[model samples]
Target: MQVNLHDAKTNLSRYVEQALDGDEVVIARAGKPLVKLVPVDSTPRRRQLGFMRNQGIATADVKGDFIDDINAMFS
Candidate 1:
């Protein structure tokens, strides 16, 4: 679907919905195609838990040290 710049601006939300629905949207200026609208991939990536489990870092010691430092700060 092709639309003129003024029409595209006037019906921006409709065009965006059409684009998200997988329809090809083209914006034109003086009948010349200027840009295409497409939906972005908005999915967030999942973080890997326990990524440092085998990295030789002691989790319990780190937690204890952090708590001790926080207690010292508040004292």
Candidate 2:
């Protein structure tokens, strides 16, 4: 579905919902295609926080016993 610049601006939310529903949306300027609207990847990536552990690299536990000392310094 193609829409002119003015109509795209006026009904931006409706077009966004259409795009999210897997519709191909195109914005045009002077009858020329300008841009497309698509949904972003919503999957959260898992991080390897302690990748270097057990490999001789020492790591600190930020939420461990040292948390009390850290709070005391701030107070």
Give the number of the best model, judged by TM-score.
2
RMSD of 1: 4.1
Indicate the residue-level lDDT of 65 in model 1: 62
- TM-score for every candidate vs. truth? 0.61, 0.64
Over the stretch 1-75, how does candidate 1's per-residue lDDT look in tens digits? 999999999999999999999999999999999999999999999999998888895557765769988888899
The 10-residue segment of model 1 with minimum total lDDT is: 57-66
Q: Model 2, 12-54: lDDT tens per residue?
A: 9999999999999999999999999999989999998988888
Whole-model lDDT, candidate 1?
Answer: 0.94
Residue 46, candidate 2: how far off, in angstroms? 1.7
- Each candidate: RMSD to true structure? 4.1, 6.1
* Poorest stretch of ten by lDDT in candidate 2: 57-66
RMSD (CA, angstroms), candidate 2: 6.1
Clash totals for all candidate models: 0, 0
